[model samples]
Each structure stands twice: as structure tokens, then as C-alpha cells.
Target: MADDPFQSRFAADASLLPHMADLANDRVLVALLAEADYRAASFLDQRLLTDRVGREWMAWDALPDLGAAAAGPHFIFHIGHVGSTLVSRLLAEVGDVLPLREPMLLRTLAQVAERIERPESVWSPELYRTRLAQTLGWLGRGFAPGQRAMVKASSVITAVADDLTGSDGRALFLHVPLPRYLETILAGEASMAETLAQAPARMARLAALLPDFPHALWQLPPVTRVAMSWLCEMATAQRRLPPDDPRRLWVDFEAMLADPAAALMAQATHFGLPIDPARIEAALAGPIMRQYSKAPEHGYTPDLRRELQAQAAADHAPAIAEAIAWVEALAARYTNLADLPILGDQSVIQEVRCSS
Candidate 1:
């Protein structure tokens, strides 16, 4: 290991992960990680930074330019609570993809990108662009020569989806129907808390798109706030990952649940990974599907999720209906949201139910 405090060893060794960026200080926090560490982590954020992991801070300028050899560090952008972590875990089981889930640095970059042009912005336009490029390059490195990096970004990171993935980049935009999204969020105390915590940021993003955005965060009920979170994320996805883009794939989480093998194959093909039916089947049948992905020790299954959603639907029927109506009203008002693909797609929902 090198003794220099300011030099980044990430280029020479992929184990040194760039955990987070300090934009104001012009340095990045790097953590030493191994293949097993990446596999074991549910998130690449502070939770994964334990006392056992070696850490250092490197000047941004000292970070090496490894862009030439970088391949896709592709993306999995989604609306929160939509089983993205599960998808990332299954993909990791497939053997050729390295999954980086919800890296804190991406969230930091997203925050900065939101105000890059404002007076309070921390980085100049030139520096921001340079750092963004460097970050992407750093993320693209994998342990093996042929393995590809797949980033599962946090939900809010979708606000910068366009920046993270340019014209030629590949990604999977995952989401669920409004009614179901509300049910899932409302069913859990922690989920509702997260929804409320993120409401202010979601509101600001929504306001940017819909200037006449009605209702302050406090004015709306909890269900309505959840709906606003969905709109902010889904609208950003629709704008950044257009329907016509060949490189981007739009997948409904319900549709994925309907046929795990098919969905996994489609995603694998999209990312140019080798597809083996046997391996896909094994991954599906393995413990990943049965256990709650974010916390593997807690047992959770598709059936359990359906039961929870059913209870939530029965318990919060009125609020769920109101939330759906609210979203429909916005769709009617905004031309951009009028044709949002999965809003009322009965066929997809029916397929999931039928398969189940």
C-alpha cells in the first residue's frame, strides 16, 4: 500500500473505492474494499464504512484519469421501494456484473448538480463537469477484465439521470403503478418516514418541472406527499430516459415479478452480459428472492409483499384512491405527464396477477 496521503490508488487497484466526494474541500473519501465486500454490502454508503475498512482522503486533482479503459458502469435508476435492491442482488448473482448500490458520492453529485448554476453552488461549471467525468470513470472500473459495473442509484439520483448517463449509456428505469406505490409506502412506518424526509427535495424538483406546482409539503396529506415523490421521480425518468431510446429499457416491477427469468434475461441482454438460462434460474431459486434484499437476514418473499400490499390497500383504500386521483389530475394538467406509460397500464398488472 502507498503511504502518500493525497494520491489516489484507485486506478492501480480497483479495491480502493471512491466512497464519497467533498466538493467544498476538493477531496474524495476512498475506502479499501474487496470483491467480497462489494458482494456483502447492501449499500455503498456510510453503513458500509466500518472501522475495519481502510480509509483515506485524496485530492480531486490527484485522481487518475482511467477513462480510456472504462466500459459501462451502467445504471439501475428507480422510484424508491420498487425492488431495485433485489434486482441488483440478483444481477450480482449472475457472475459477470459488479453491483454498486446507492453510492453516497452519486447523491452528493446530484445535490451539487441541482444548484450548479446558482450563487450557492460549490463548484464552477468546468470543475463540476470534470469531477463528474472523473467520478464516472472511477465507478466504471471492475475487479476482472470482462466484468461490468452496474450502479443502482438512489431514487433522488434520478434527478441527474441525464447527466450520469449520456446518449450512448445504458440503463434500466424501474417503477410501479401509483396505487401500488402508495400502498407499499403507507404500509410501513419507516417507508412513510422516508417519504416525508424526502418530500422537501421532491417538492423542489417537482416545482422545477411544474412551476405552478400546487400545495406546499405541509399542506398535503401523507398519501399525497407519497404521490408527489413518485411524480417527481417518474417524471424525471420519463424525461431523461425517453421511450424511444434503444439503450434504455423501461421495466415495471410488477412485470418483472410476473416472469423473473424473462425480466432478468432482458436486462442481461441489454447490458451485453452473457445470458445463461440455468444461471438465471438458479439466481431466482436461491435465497436472494426469498429474503429482503436490503437486509438479507429478514425473510421476505413476493407472496409476503403481496399480502402486505393487500392489507395496506384494505386499510388505506380511501387515501390510495385519492392519491391516484391526484396523480391523474396532474397528468391531465401537464402535457408531459399525460402519456406516462405505466400509470394505468392494466395489461401489465393483469399479467402479474395472472402469473401469480
Candidate 2:
């Protein structure tokens, strides 16, 4: 192989080979990656969000398949905004648990297993099964016997919980849907439409290969619109399953972020995890606080806000009214800034939230 001579740094430094070999061997890299992942700065953490997924369950189906029981004590966490990242990062600090962001272990096994058939498209189910077990074994290689670790996964996997649970493993579900998190990223003088527009190009290529889906939807702009569609799709699917299934949990992000100390305590108590106070505080104050504080104070003129509210009301009167009522109810649940005192009217923000 070396005789073929593809000149590169790969040949220059044999040390680099050790890192790759260790990663292939599933030794140093996994733990190192796990630590580096949790320690990453706020928006850049990419723990659960290594892609442009906006940090939620909708991103799960997009991941490579790992057959059954790849992850146990499954944290089918559905989250909204950047705050969910903070929560996840904090959870990793617990000594008993090795908080996996999105582990490549399972998928790596799946890929290798699939190689047996050497097919161009899909692998046989048996190969997938083989790979899945191999991956799970490797995941626990670093853990002390009888020690348990949890996988915090994207909620999109809610559709496949039965495939994931095993007699040896348990599951815990958590939700952290920020009521107005989309606003943080979408509404800053930066139009959601603009963010969505970039998505079509990416979706175009994806649709060609994933013909099971409608290509027409690919025309929808990328970031905001495409992201929103995935959320609705995944969230609706998750809601359909019974809560008793041990397959899911739902959290209102605004509620948790409003008082994380209390919320964190409740979650740890409920989920039966160690409460690592120092880590929790570090995560919250580190990334989430910085991101929200630095978020743009996008100035939308009163005239513009008024025009938008009026237009939204006219376009969908019943839905708009229903949304307003929902907001009122939500405001009561999350008291502080539910209806920002600075706003001219509640209806204005309602238009953005409901976008009816």
C-alpha cells in the first residue's frame, strides 16, 4: 500500500497513526472525545448537536443505524435552544456516568458488520445485529464492572425505543423544549426565511439519495424552515407514544432554564443520577449564560411588529386566537418574562411564537 505512494502527512508522522489506531481500537479516543465534547464552549459544544440540527430529538433518525440495544439507560432527551446543551454538559460531570454525546461506537460496528455483504446500499439484518453487540461491548470496555453509563440521545430515536432496550439496561426520558428558544436564533433582525433559504441546497442532495421522502419539501429553505419541519415531524411522533413507555420525557425549556438549580435537582432525583453541583453550575454559567446574554437584541420596529401581528391575525383568525390563549396559559406557567413588560402588546410576541 505504501508503494502506491499517496504523499501526505499520514506518512510523515507515525504518531498520528497511533491516535487513529487507538480510535479504531476503541481505547484512548472515546474517553478523550467524551471529555473534549462536554468541555467545549456553549454553542460550540456539539455534544448532542454535531450538525446543524438545532439541538433536539429530530436529529436522531438522521444518525447512522446501530441495530438494537446499542445504547442503554437511554436518555431520549428532547431539547430546545442552547440551554439543553448546557444541561447535557452538566450531566456528564457525574462520576458514575459517562455522558456520551453521540457515540460513533454503534454506527462504526454497523458499518463494519454491513461490510460482510459488501453491498452498495443496505446491509442484512444479521450483520447489523452482530455489529450492534460488538459496539456495545466496546462501549463498556473502559467502565469498571457493574458500573453504568448513560447515553443522552436525540429524541428522533423515539420511534425506535423497543429496538434499543435490553434486559440488562434501563431507560430514562427527559424533555427540555424551550418555549421561545427558536426566537433566540431566529428573530434577531435576522429573518427565519433567510436562515431557511440555505437549506434547500443541502436537502436537494439528501433527497436524491433518500427518495423515500418527498423531493418537493426539499425546495423549502434550509436552516430555519427545514429545521422546523423536522421538529414538528419528530415531536409529533414522540407525542403519539404513551408516556409510560419509558421511551420518552417532555420538558418545557423555559421552565427549566428559568430555575435550573431546582430543575436540575428534580431531574437528578427523578432519573436517579448523581448531582454534580460544581459541574452543573459550570455548564449553566459557562455556555448558556454567555450565549443568551450575548444574543443579539434585534430591533424590530413597533410599526413592523404591529403590521406582522395584524397580518397573522387576519391570515388565521381561529388559530391565531387559539395561540394567543395558549400563550396566556404558558405565561402563567412560566411567570417572569413570558410576557416581557417591555413589549407594547403580548400579541406581537405571540405572532412570532405561534407564527400563525
Candidate 3:
């Protein structure tokens, strides 16, 4: 029999090369990347991909209906700086799952969601829904048979969390409590600085959630501003999560670090991944856990992280203290957030509140 184009995974080009979709014009533009450089870059920087990789384009309207295609792809949704990428990388050790780390299409759809309510909007909710469904269908395509697709979405895309994990799909929401979030950001070389710099743009989109939000939030200290963004995203995810839904799960980054193997197995079971007990044991003993999940070249043991966080907390005590206070003050404004496992416990809250 002649070779089917789609069956030839390497030659299918669409399946082999990474692709980014743009919905700017009257039509959608699908740009296929031709190089393997910077596979670790954020989906938002996908345009820079053209500089390194060759490209090919396909108009969105010209494509056939993908709505009826696979719909149950898994997702790793998170607040920024949590260990989501680590979890995604670990999950890929399972033989049957193909993990996609922040696809550009998802970021595009998410950006679309942000502008959905604009006055001069050219896109309607229905159109957005259809496009997302089709785009996800294309992304869900497994590079090889029997391999399921899992996506680690960008934290900003949490704006579309519910839409992405609708009836067909399942997801895990990863986050840390307010104090740890501040600690992680502060410990990083430039993550906190970068987040602070982008506050105006990110806060503009979140203003509707809190009355007089953007202006009010901007008045706060730089540390407090970043903390507010974390709370906003967490609050959004909390509201969208349905009670007693087996398809959705909430995980604490701290807990995962304390006992990684248990966390991985539980997550695997939750996602219905049939990883063998032996394989799970082997993976835990492997080198993946020894290095930083995002920057595999660097070492990132739990002890090292603890030392760094402790040092960071001590060094940035004044700023971290102010940021924690800001978070507690805003907690009442989001009572729904108070019910979360991370935020609800007054003991945990008080502990962090009194820290430093």
C-alpha cells in the first residue's frame, strides 16, 4: 500500500515541525517552524522562531473541520513560577504521553480571550470558541499512535482555563501559597524583576476583577503588585473549578517538592496514565529529578532550593514582608480564595503573616 501522508510522522511536517497560529487577519496563519533552536522559549516569542527556522504557512479557513477530532487532551494549568514545567517533564517519562511545553497556539487563543470584551472587537465569543476547539484538536494530534498529548500551558493563559478543560478534557492546577510564591520569584535571577516590569500590561487585563483595580494596584509597592497578579490568577482558577470534579486537581508546589515520587504517581493515576510501578520507581531514581526541570543543564535539588529560598527570604525580608501583608489585606476581597487548601487555613496564613 502507498504511504499515507499523515501516517508518515516525520514527513507529515505539520506533526514533525512545531507550529504557531495567528488569527490577526481575516484568516488564520499557521506558521510551521523549521529549526529546533530555543525549544525552551516562551510561546509569546514564537515570532522570533522565523529567524532560526524555515517556515511554511496554511490558512485556517482552508482547513477541514477538526472539531470531531480527539478532545480529551490533558493540561497542566498553573500560576506563574510553580513547578508545572517540572511535572510536565516528569510525566513525559511515561511511555505513552507526548508532552507539549507551552504551545504558541494556546498563548494566542489566551491573548484572544483577554481582548474578547473590547469595544472594537472583531472576534465574537462563538468564533473564539470554534477556533479554540479547532486549534486544540490540531494540537492534540499525537506524533505517534497510542501516545496521548499533554500540554503545559503558559500561566497567563489561565484566563482560558475553563474553556480549555471543558467537558472533554482534564487538568491539574499547580500553585504555591503567597509566601512561597514571593520567595521563588525573589530567589530567581530576574523573574521577579521581569514580572514587576510587566505589571501595567498584566494588571490592565485583570482590572475588571477588582473595582478600580489597575489604578489601585499600581499604587502599591513593586513586590505587592506582583503578589496581586498571583492572587488574581489563583482566584480565577478557584472560581472556575467545580466542586468534587474528578477531572480537575489542585497541587501545591511545596508538597510536590517534599515528596516527588508520590506526587508523580498520584498525578499519573489522576491523568489515567498507565505508568508501571517499576517504571515510576526507575524514573524517580533517574537524572531528570537531579537537574532543574526548566533548565535541565542546571542542578536543582530540594535542599539547594530550600537554602536559596531561606537566603532570599532573609536578604529580601523587608520587601517579602510588605508583599505578604498586601496579600492578606486583599484576601477578604476574594473570600472565595479563602476556601482554597493553600489559602483557607488561618494557621498557614498567620504563620506566613508573622514571618520575618
Candidate 4:
């Protein structure tokens, strides 16, 4: 490595590497270079995105130890279409916190586990465990004193929760209530299109979860297919998350949106991150709430979303109604899932209580 000013400066900062951000077709690890800090980045995308700066190809043999430099790198595990992104963005607003949203490395590991193939000669579960821990250690390095590192994983990555969190690690399993989740999928053309396009992949994931998932599930109504996918994800969350683990917390999207300050503060407390209540309030009132968390240029407000949902419901009345009915019928069919909110039980409204 040459000693150029930019390279020299960034090299010393152990917080730079995001493990397996670029796993090439040939199994080499390519590093996607960005500024050391992602404070100005967007959370709308699955991965932590930044202005393209440069790239570096790294050999595992040459990889340095980062774990010692890292502080506590907490995780925000969530179900898709929820407000996980919003929570991540708010946390990053604290200036000292580095929030990595959906690192591709974790996703690759999850896929590898499902397929049961070692893509590289040197790759193994133990290798991934060591490399990921070291990378996380580096990520845990706070930009300043007492800063925290947080990772917001994609919902599907719940398959590898054990590897990610390890024993005695902490995580927050986040999801939207069943009705809101269905409406979220049905209300947006993009959402509906994505659901259709990813149907095959979702089915493959469900097959892993439900041993007897019928082959005819694909032939069922599209609405039912989406419902099944949601169920599979929920089941994953429930399975991986230890109900009695004090370190593990469960949250619903509706609760967070209803009370941003309290919810954010509670999450901060849960993760052991130090935050000023005044600063959190300021951030909530500022751009984080006013702008689209994903694409800040587009303004976002509660009223705007409600209006859009109403318009969508009116435009796609039949489809929305069918989707709702399909979910209701499924809920009733599975009496064993009575405790699950999606199963149409009103008592399940606040199963995972947050600190009010």
C-alpha cells in the first residue's frame, strides 16, 4: 500500500472496511471504498450507500484485525416493509453512531448457508465467523469517544441470526402489525411489483422454513402468496429470537411511528447507546422526519402516506379487498397461530411491549 494522503489517512481509520461488500463471481473479496463515516448516507437502500470514492481488492490472507478497534456493534433485525430503515436513519443522526444498513456480506453468508456450498476454497462456517467478527470489531470503532456501531440487516438475513449475533449478543427484531404489513404491500405499485418479481425467491425461502409448504402455494392467489411470505418471515423472527433473552427486544412499526421520540429513546437504551433526549427530539423534528428516510429529496409526512394509501385503496379496491380477505381467512384457518398478530387476534396487539 502506497502512502498517499487520502490512503494514508483512511488506512489508519479501522472503521473503513465493510466485510464482503463485493464478493466477485470468482470468490475474491472486493472492497467497496467509501468515506470513513456514513453520516451523510441514505438508508432507503438495503445496503449502506455512499458517494463512490474508490475500490480495493483484499485477500483474506492480508486482512487486518479490526475487532479490537470496534466498540459494540449492535444489530437491528427486521421484517421487510417495516420502519427499520427509519429507525436506522434516526440512530445515525446522533453523529457518533455509524449505521450499516443491510450489508451484502451478511446476505451472502445467509445464501451460502441455505445452499450449503463453499464458494471459495478457504471459506467455511468458522472462516466466516472469524472474518465477520473481526470486520464487526473494526466497524465497532466509534468515530469519537463513546460512539456506537449499529447494523440494520435485511429481513431475510434472519436465517443467519445465530452467526450474526452469536451467544450473549443483542438484537431488536422489528416488524409491522399484520394488517399494516399487508396494506403496505398492496398500497404501492412498486411494492406489488416487487412482491410478484420476487415470488420465486420468496417461495424458496418459505420452503426452507415450512417443510410441507405445498407446491400448489404458487398457484394460490397472489394475495395469499404474499401472506405466506410474511408468515414465513415472522416464524423466522419468532424462532431465532429467544423470548426470555433480556438482550433481545421485539418491536412493531406502528408503535414506533406512533411515538418516535419515546421509541427511539427506548431503542437507544436497549442497545446501550448514549443519546441526548434533546438531540433526538431535534432530529425527529428536523430532516429525518420531514424528508423521505430512503430518498430525502422527496418529502415524507404521515399525512402524505395516509393520502397515498387511501388513493391506492380506491384505485385497487378489488385487489386490496381480496388481499385483506385472504389474510383474514388464513388467520382463522391457523388457530395455533392465535398468539401471532397476523392471525387476527386483537389481544396480540402489544405482545412485545416497548418502554412507554
Q: For residues 315-342, what per-residue lDDT tens digits would candidate 3 score against the true structure?
A: 9899888877767766556565456544
**Root-mean-square deviation (CA) per prediction:** 2.2, 12.6, 4.5, 4.9
- Backbone collision count in every prediction? 0, 7, 0, 6
TM-scores for all predictions: 0.95, 0.48, 0.84, 0.80
State each model's CA lDDT, in order. 0.85, 0.40, 0.69, 0.64
Ranking by lDDT: 1, 3, 4, 2
Candidate achieving higher TM-score, 1 or 3? 1
Residue 188, candidate 2: alpha-carbon lDDT: 35
Task: Give the per-residue lDDT digits (tens) of candidate 1, residues 1-356.
Answer: 15544344566566889999887788989899998898889899999889999999878777776664455489999999999999999888875988899989998898888889999998888877877887888888888888888999999898888889876789999999888788889889999999999999888889888868776888778898999999988888888888678888888897789888999999999988898999999999999999999999999998888778879989999988888888888888888998785365778777665654
Q: What are the clashing pairs of model 4?
A: 44-294, 66-138, 67-137, 70-140, 70-141, 71-140
Q: How accurate is candidate 3 locally (lDDT)?
A: 0.69
Candidate 4 C-alpha lDDT tens digits along 263-293: 8888888887776998898888887777766
What's the true lDDT of residue 176 in model 3?
83
Per-residue CA lDDT of model 2 for 228-330, tens digit only, reads: 4333323333443334454334444444544567667666655566677775676555544433321323333223433553554454455433433433443
Mark the regions of model 4 whose C-alpha exceeds 4 Å error after superposition. 1-15, 19-37, 43-52, 67-72, 117-122, 215-217, 314-336, 343-356
Off by over 4 Å in 1: 1-9, 354-356
TM-score of candidate 3 to 2 decimals: 0.84
